[model samples]
Target: MADLRVLIVDDDFHVARLHATWVDAVPGFAALAPVGTAALALQAAHSLRPDLVLLDTYLPDTTGLELLRTIDTDAIMLTAASDPESVRTALRRGALGYLIKPFSADDLAAALRGYARYRRVLAGTGSLDQAGLDRARRALLGGADAPSSGGPSRSRSATETAVLEALAQGPGSARALLSAAEVAAVVGVSRATAQRYLAALAEDGAVEIQLRYGSTGRPEHRYGLSA
Candidate 1:
């Protein structure tokens, strides 16, 4: 299946880049260049016709809610705007998701995953039965897809999920290795906790481990997602 194309709109270049990185790290999404103004965002949306947009509530030219009213594609609000009025307006304007700022990559990944699943459920169909509609709604609201039967299943803890998402955002090259401390900072956990999760993931073949040898103390253990 083709990946979902995402256009990120935010006034802060750094925040936009971070969002793009998080969006790209998800399995079924790709992000276009970030735009800082509503005008540029509208132009890009017209030219690119992205599958979805990661929009902020604030922009240099106009409010994101205003742009959302104008755009023809789907959107998810990513902003520091915590006001209830802002949230209601974004939803009223047809935002598919709303994420407050200072969220971890894990949070964004979950939203992306949910949206992807929602799209999949509603794709290629002219009409839906009640069950189908219910499934699609559940998927859109962050419910996990039903697991396949007859296999031993182990659901990951929230911390484990966060750890995996952090690793998924790595550079994916020679320098992709991330230390436990780095993972800890990203996941908002202690280094020991991060290391424990990393070790567990490695044991489960969910991540790749590399050792960094130094002249000083012990070799530093680093991790990346398995290909």
Candidate 2:
């Protein structure tokens, strides 16, 4: 298969180059020269005909969605603008994926892999079977087609489900995630009981626990959802 050509569009020179480098590092992807304005992006797309574009929401000349309307190939938006309107517009304008900013390189790689699969499926010769069509559809969405079997998402014993729900929705910062004591209070259980549940959940990829450090005290386990 041929390498997937990607045009990265962002206003910041440093960020654009960083993403360009990351794209080039991926096994089946190559980065085109990035552009800082929507006008340049449109021109690049017209002339270069890249397989995909990594676009930002804001451009010095126009909005990314505006540029999206003119481009013919697939696009995956990578932008800091997390507003509902922008997300909706990107989808409505035919974006293939929406990746929020501050994402890891792994996240971008996953998207690229999914896009590659989608393109491959589309290029297949024969009519697709149910499974083949399903794979193609899931690739565009960039995640598993099914809801997680673990966590608070399924039917289970009443006691177990209630505890999972609490941890799944638990909110905390990087510095201070909800501790076992806090989760215990929320779920009407003892601290030790909450800790046991959290540990189990973490092992199952339902949630994660990290230590929060402070200048004056020892680090403590803080709980957050794996997502």
Candidate 3:
């Protein structure tokens, strides 16, 4: 089979570029375009007709969900919105895979491979047994639980649980989490307190942190659960 064509759409220029690079790095994939707006994305989908789309839930001009409803392409949602409701909405709206942001190259590659396998099965190229489907569903929905490498045994508080749930949706640096603030606000804590909790989780091996650098002054750190 020929390499699958991919279209990446995100309002953030950096994110769009990053996704494009990741897709290009995949052996059986080629990035057709990385667009920064819903309008452009729609146009690309109509014209380029990529095999897959990496979509973001939040956009500058329109909700990613709204754009998704209109597009005819096979889509995989890539978003920082990790809430259950959002995830449910994405899945219900026909997203093949839902990936939270700040994902590692390995995780992204895994998602792509899973989606490719799904496509093959759907196209009647391969038989999808009940067991295989079950396993794929578990992986798609983040149910393939893998234990963390190292972490303290302290029980997670309710607030901590909320924070972890948010992180599970996508990776974020402490600064980014502070900027979003929804999880912290939902859990009824100050931003400073949330940072401390993130630090603790990182220390416990519940989350992993990566240093991100750009043209900006200081390199920022992002966190995500060790999936």
Per lDDT, the best of the predicted structures is 1
Please give, for residues 106-178, the per-residue lDDT of candidate 3 as tens digits: 7886677556545433555577788767755664443331121134566677767888877655435433332
Q: TM-score for all predictions?
A: 0.66, 0.61, 0.57
lDDT of 2 at 104: 83
- Evaluated against the true structure, the overall lDDT of model 2 is 0.76
lDDT of each: 0.79, 0.76, 0.69
Instruction: Kindly list the per-residue Cα lDDT of model 2 for residues 1-227, writing each as its tens digit.
Output: 45689999999999999998777655457899899998898889999999999999989999999988888988999999899999999999999899999898778877886676577666758998998788787867663322222445555555455666776666654233687778788889887656655655554566676666678634566777676
Which ten-residue region of model 3 has the weakest summed lDDT? Answer: 141-150
TM-score preference between candidates 1 and 2, better one: 1
Highest TM-score among the candidates is held by which one? 1
**C-alpha RMSD by candidate, in order:** 11.1, 13.3, 14.8
For residues 84-159, write the lDDT of model 1, one tens digit per residue: 9999999999999999998998798778877876776677558888887888778667764432101124777788
Off by over 4 Å in 2: 129-131, 143-227
Name the 10 consecutive residues with the lowest summed lDDT in model 2: 143-152
Report the alpha-carbon TM-score of model 2 versus the true structure. Answer: 0.61
Put the candidates in lDDT order, highest first.
1, 2, 3
